[model samples]
Target: MKWNPQDIETFLQSKEYVDTAVLPLLPVAFDSEMGQAAGMSEFITLVTGQLERQFKGRLLLLPGFSYLKTCEEEKLFTDLLLWESQLKESGFSHIFYLTSDLFWKSAESRLDGSLIWIPSIPLETMQEAQKISVVESQVKQMLTLFTGKWHEKE
Candidate 1:
């Protein structure tokens, strides 16, 4: 089954968030015109490298949520939902991303099976380094615990 993405602040991860990383969303307007927006895509790729260096397998980013001059969060969210569906088929159990806007104020798709809008932390409230630490500490804790348990299983 597939789920649609919700733009409200209600469809977020259950844990509280701290906002450590800056997710780059290149403008969608000039993507086929000026070629500047593509830079944002490249930047996202570079950031993905950093993410791999850090979180590796535990990363969740909306695929095409960057609209250069468009105010359509619903469309962006729709793409994100599609991405999540595909990712889940590939074995992803958890997803996380840093959203920069106050989603509750925005109107989005009301489609059935859409991702519910919920954020663990309001984007406006997260401090930069604090977000990073929260993610890092949690990932470290999960990894260490899993590693220990796996060794015992062996």
Candidate 2:
């Protein structure tokens, strides 16, 4: 479920079943890497949207957690851990952090939740049909990872 009034209502009604939450980790850069930051955001947004649709009733798709690309690593991790703590306290059993950023990979072991990192694919140049195809393909791959994680808990 997307984070909105209506979805939040539905989620509250069915809170027990929606045990997972997906948070997109987006990077923002105002300098020369602006284009790269935009691409990462776009790619992750599309992929996470598709993922949420696929498992609509089972998970909540929270807003992207945006951070400056130049932010201090220690600060970023601390902030992210806070998010995880809050989500757990709110009753989400599985929290997934989706991102195209490689930095998270190094810190994965420190996180209580799972971190999914997919390389960004620039979709600005693709046709509408191509874009849909690519996003669907990526979501298909993620389906396996998500299900595997769910099964592990079972």
TM-score of each: 0.35, 0.98
The alpha-carbon lDDT assigned to residue 89 of candidate 2 equals 100
lDDT of 1 by residue, 1-154 (tens): 0122532132244212211122334454543543444543443433433443454223333343465444566676676567556645644444333222334225333321222222233223457676565445544544554345334534
**Candidate closest to the true structure, highest TM-score:** 2
Decoy 2 TM-score against native = 0.98
Least accurate stretch of 10 residues (summed lDDT) in model 2?
Answer: 145-154
Q: Which regions in candidate 2 have their CA more than 4 angstroms from the true location? A: none
lDDT of the candidates, in the order given: 0.39, 0.96
Q: In lDDT terms, which candidate is top?
A: 2
* Tens digit per residue, CA lDDT, model 2, 80-128: 9999999999998899999999989999999999999999999999999
Cand. 1 TM to true fold = 0.35
